[model samples]
Target: MKQRGIWPDEFTFAPLLKACANLEDLEMGQGVHKHVLALGFGRFGSIRIGIVELYSGCGRMMEAKKVFDEMPHRDVILWNLMVKGYSQSGNVDMGLGLFRQMGERTVVSWNLMISLLAQNGREKEALALFHEMRNGEFEPDEATVVTVLPVCAQLGELDLGRWIHSYAKSKGLYPNLVSVGNALVDFFGKSGDLETAITIFNDMPRKNVVSWNAAISNCAFNGKGELGVQLFDEMLDEGVRPNDSTYVGAFACCAHAGLVQRGGDLFDSMIANHDIEPTIEHYGCMVDLLGRGGCLKEAHKLVETMTMEPNAAIWGALVSACRTHGEMELAEYALKELIKLESWNSGNYVLLSNIYADRGKWEDVEKVRVLMSGNSIKKAPGQSTIV
Candidate 1:
């Protein structure tokens, strides 16, 4: 069009910069910036948003802010973009400041800030903000419902979550949006309401991979291993391909219920049938299953031969199994591996000392005590939060 002597307007560069931003191509965005300035389009609000989008999308927050500060008339969309830009840069404080400064707000704006808070480990603040959003003029939308349900689940805010579930149903959001149904399933399941979780799962208008994952994992969590495994089988029969997380939950159910042979079949078929490569998480679950079933040697061998290095959780599982099965020597070895990975964890030393004590080796127990003293480690007392 330019070669044909057709001039580019605000429409041309706004999306071009958006594309650059989406691709995170800083150099291409800068070139577009130069074109915008040469064409005097930077003065236009829409074009300025594109400029901000390009800069912030590429993680250049300062440049985006400069463009943002110069805008004479900022709409809620621009404010939302600024919040998004700051959140993308992991600058939650700046995003919150911009959010608070907005003269007017939209659900998109609230959603942006709430998501930034939740993703940054500020669940309490995110929940508060959601309440504020509710108390105010703006009604939570589908995005708000999806984003906050997990935070509610994390915080054990059962009342708030139930309210949101009702709100979604009232707004005709649940089951209509597969994501809303999936979120409700996850929230209810984690909240220890397996009955409601399963109800939602069955009532979902559609079920995706995530829907199945939430159900199977929740069943595993609630110690309903039989039902969990049945769901896994049903999922396969329904021709929905299980991903890495699906196998993790299924293997965990096997471990919990002592279905070692079933776990092994799933592990083998994960590669053979589904073509999904086993990650370390899958291997961890299988090792956990073998260990729980008293197959110490097989579990140990699998840990040593893992494609990726076994992490602390794997060693912890092995040591826990050893104690349960009275395999003191293997427990000692697994504890040592666990210690190498987490030397500061006093529990590993305590476990090692206990293993020695079980074996009538007082001297080894004293040495483990000395190791703990030398490292300035203290056993963290077990505490439970009622909420």
Candidate 2:
């Protein structure tokens, strides 16, 4: 603009700075900031916000804080931006500090705090905050419903999730808002209410691929692979084209039920019919399916011939199958692959030791114990929960 003899005015720098922020181009953002200072727009509220946003988006929370502190006066909006920056950058403590300091909290502020807590695995705290928000006279909005619903799902808080569903209905949220409806289905399915989940799915005014995927996976999770297969067939009949996730749900069904031929045919169809290239996850599922079906040689051959590098999940599945069938030689081979893939993971080592012990190979078990001690590898203690 300068070269073209067009002088940049105050309004000019605001959009330019915003562009830099959106692109997360800190170098260009800094250059724009320098230009804003040179043009006497450094004190501009909009420009400062843009600068804060740019630094924050790039994960430079300290720089964002600096720009924020330099402002002549801070408003709730600016404070919210800073809170978001700290939260997203994994500085949850700093975010909580700023949130606590806010004089007036908007719905967005509450949602951000709740989401931040949930993101950091503080689900119970997030739910508590949601209760607090309600006590403070703030009605749950769509964003609040979307944010807190996942927390309910995670904790298996069926009563809370049902209340949220009721609230959404009261507010006329579901059926129109597909996301909330989908989340409801997922929450119900995960909370061991597959019947309710399927009912919700069937009653949805409109259904997307996600709806089908969730319903199918819900059935697969409860050892209803045949029902999952039925769901997939129905999904196809409904013309909802399946994605990788869809295939994954279908393959999971095959694995649990040991439907080897169906899994193999579906694996072929993924490429031949759908044109969706197989990801490592897809390969892992196929390996698991073959292994669980007792076709150890075929499973091993699949892993060895995979175009992508075989991951631990693929090898681990084989090891598990070998352990089940007492295929000592195959178990050893799977253990080798597992160790090669994840040398630090002590679960596979312990599994191999157990396999040897089960076969009365005390020398091999002792060798495994020595290797573990020499490498400083320790198996994580197992924990059982009644719930």
Candidate 3:
């Protein structure tokens, strides 16, 4: 169109800019912005929104702000976009500020900030926001229900969660929106209401891979590994494609049940039958199972040959097994690896020192004490609070 000397309209630029935003193609977006301005299309709200979306989506909040401030009229959608962009960048305060500044807020706006707070560990604030939203004109929607259920669960507000569950059912959110169902299942599962969680899962009008993952994983979370494994098999039979989380849940269940042989078979099936490469979580679960079952030699071999670096959790598991099995040398090695990862955590030094002392290795214990002294590390108390 440009080659033919035909000018592009806001309709043409809207999707183009949106595509740039989605792709994170800031340079292309900038080029489009320049073209939009040159064509005197900047006055159009659609054009302005597209430009803002492009800048904000690329994490260039400053540029997005410049465009946003220049717009004489900003809709809820544009304001929500800014909030969401800041939220994605982990600037929750900025997102909150934007949200508060909005003269009018939509459910999407409330959901964005609520979800942001919930995800960033501000569960209390997120729950507060949900209550605040309840008093407002924009009642809780599907997204609001999904976001708040977990917060209620985390804070042990079981009664509140039950209320939300009822609200979801009354609002017709439960079965229609699979996400709401998934969230309800997860909330109940985490709260140790396995029977209710399963009932909700079974009653959902539809189920997806995520729904299945939640059901299986929750069983694992509650140490119902046998049931979780059964759910995994049931999922496979139902033709749901299993992803990495599915395997993680399955392995965790087997590990919890001390079903080493079944875990090994599932791991083999993941690789051979499903073409799913085991992730660190899968590997960690296998190591945990092996260690718990006294398969130290095999766990050590698996760790040594892992394609990725074994995280501190894996080394910590090995250290635990070494302690249980009286493998002092392996304990030292695992403790050393853990120390390298988190030198600030004083538990590692304390544990290693205790092990050395138990074996009458006074010299090694002395070295560990000296090391702790040099690093100014101290043992943690039984519990601590920020206050």
* 1 or 2, greater by TM-score: 2
What TM-score does prediction 3 earn? 0.93
* Candidate 2 C-alpha lDDT tens digits along 90-179: 888889899999998899889989999999998998999899999999988888988998899898888999999999888988867878
* Candidate 1 global TM-score: 0.89
Tens-digit lDDT track for model 3 on 88-201?
A: 888989999989999998788898899999889999999888888888867788888988998998999999999999988898987899999999999999999999999999
Clashing residue pairs in candidate 1 are none
Estimate, for each residue in 1-387, the C-alpha lDDT of model 1 and write its tens digit. Answer: 879999998889988988998899999989989999998888887789888888887889899889888888889988888898888788889899989999999888899899999999999999999989989979898999999999999999999999999999999998799999999999999999999999999999789999999999999898888789999999999999999999999998887788999999999999999898888789889888999899999999999988889999999989888889989899899999999999988778877877787678888877887787788977668721111
Report how far residue 207 has shifted in candidate 1, in Å: 1.2
CA RMSD of each candidate after superposition: 4.1, 3.7, 3.3
Q: Least accurate stretch of 10 residues (summed lDDT) in model 1?
A: 378-387
What would the TM-scores of all predictions be? 0.89, 0.91, 0.93
Where model 1 places Cα greater than 4 Å from the true spot, the runs are 1-10, 360-387
RMSD of 2: 3.7
Q: How high is the CA lDDT of each candidate model?
A: 0.90, 0.86, 0.90
What is the Å distance of residue 142 in model 3 from its true position?
1.6
Identify the leading candidate in terms of TM-score: 3
